[model samples]
Target: MDDRRELPRKLAHEHLARGDATGWFEALYAEADGKEQVVPWADMQINPHFAAWLAAHPRPEAAKRALVIGCGLGDDAEALAAVGFQVVAFDVSPTAVAWCRDRFPASTVQYAVADLLKLPEDWIGRFELVLEIYTVQVLPVELRRQAFERMAQAVAADGTLLVIARGRDATDEPCNMPWPLLHDELKFIETCGLREVSFEDFLDQECPPVRRFRAEYRRPATITSAKS
Candidate 1:
């Protein structure tokens, strides 16, 4: 396998040297979309933890619905489906959606092209399980809070929201590209009323060790409205 460990940091270094990480994302995606290049979720290493987590949590077998945000190619969605969850995976790029559909023709998964930040109100609270793997951090820091709230609102009252994100130690340099999550960033979800049930950090040994957080949040079963 092509080593993924050094690539992200290398890209970040390039972006930092250029002093335009955000611009780099924009330019890269623009070229990718232009060339109709559909990036695959498998390319992101979504399996190792996600697959094991899904295996451990099984979704009760009766819970059928799932929503995956920013599903580039569909490997993770397919993994969920293989475990009996009917998944609706959505990405903003039409090229990515088309690529997923073509790649998984016989798979019991649906792929759609939609902006995650602007999901329709009708879709709110509709999923039994929501998978957000590294998507929130991709947004600029200014929009990160609002983006997380939107993601939390999409989960049903009793559903689970699975988050897998890259992180860095508080003392580490504030670099870009795969922007690491900060402590206050984690609090934004709590401010939106979602409760964190479990959290674990995965650390890998390499030249620049990889640090990531896997967390699960759930909406409360009961909430009193002002009118109630």
Candidate 2:
């Protein structure tokens, strides 16, 4: 088997053994940088689903704030910026953040190192749109719930949250790295006070069709009472 095939598993075991659930992300990106190969999840393009969604529902110029969680390699971030968003794209790995900045020297997206679990206080409810793709599924199963909550917390009231990830049915046994999210798990976003605008599950056109879900949720507008 190619070392690249085993790289994620090996990194997961090493980091999880040391009680570092999220450290494998940084380690894997560093290794990929050294090897000069495409990272497993790096398609070198923005997610097609995200692009399609943007086309159908163009955001207003005044509602330009966007947040990209686990922004790898800056492709998605750049895509958001190209569409007129004031984007803040962040990854837990400093190496990944630095790589994105260096890769897109002329980019308008602000790339930074930010842990999803311990986000900055000021960032809470700060973005008009939050894009979360494949980030939660990569976390240890134990951390998925909290990660989901934090991601939801970033969306400003009346904003939108879009999530795309590998999906599995309730009966499938839990697997390792890139753990597929269950349907119920994805539905948990409603628990964070956002209303589901849409949810779709489909198979991608890969050799072996990959099961995935694309979900959009929106924060309801807050009603303020008139002061006499």
Candidate 3:
């Protein structure tokens, strides 16, 4: 791994070890502002899977609402806004939200500081689309289930949840920083009253290809359908 990349990872591990479950996010963003090279996950581009999904599955209405979890640097949030969704993108770090707004002064994306585990009441069941990319994997395993529940709760009755995360086999031991999601863990998202619409496992195009899971789950229009 690149030494520069390891800086934020080390900071994350240090903070998480000290029982600060979310402080490392702020520290990482603050450090990245000073030295952009430290943000290993900052691709500076919208996720291609999201883009392709949006292209192939356009919403009937142009004014849908979208929620982007852990909206780092606002790239994906901005992309959603560009496609005409009223977007609310949030991160746990105040610094990250401020940086995102500053980066896009006239942007339509409403960037805010919000915790996934303790989401705002008004946000529950309000979004037509919820996008989560690599956020839960960075969290401690104990917090992942709550994070998933919050993500699911934000979706409207007919809304869709898009999740993209690093994938690992079920038997793989938990690793540092981003603890890759096991296949069963990914499937667990369905337990939150959503139906799995599509699921795919593929190798990312990067050298020494990274395994990834790209999935879509939808909250059915009715309780009966959702249960089925």
On residues 117-181, what C-alpha lDDT tens digit does candidate 2 reach at each position? 99888889999999999999888778888988998899998999999999998788777677888
Q: Looking at model 1, which ten-residue stretch has the lowest summed lDDT? A: 33-42
TM-score of each: 0.79, 0.94, 0.93
| 2 versus 3: better TM-score goes to | 2
Ranking by TM-score: 2, 3, 1
RMSD of each: 4.8, 1.8, 3.1
- Candidates 2 and 3 compared: the better one by lDDT is 3
The per-residue C-alpha lDDT of model 2 at residue 124 equals 95
Tens digit of per-residue lDDT, candidate 3, span 41-105: 77778988777787888654758999999998889999999878999999998988998888789
Candidate 3: pairs in clash: none
Give Cα-based local distance difference scores for all models: 0.73, 0.86, 0.87
User: Candidate 1 on 33-147: residue-level lDDT in tens?
Assistant: 5343222224633457788788787465584788999886778999888878889898876766776787789988888878777886876998878898878766567778777
Top-lDDT candidate index: 3
Number of backbone collisions per candidate: 0, 0, 0
Off by over 4 Å in 1: 1-46, 205-208, 223-228
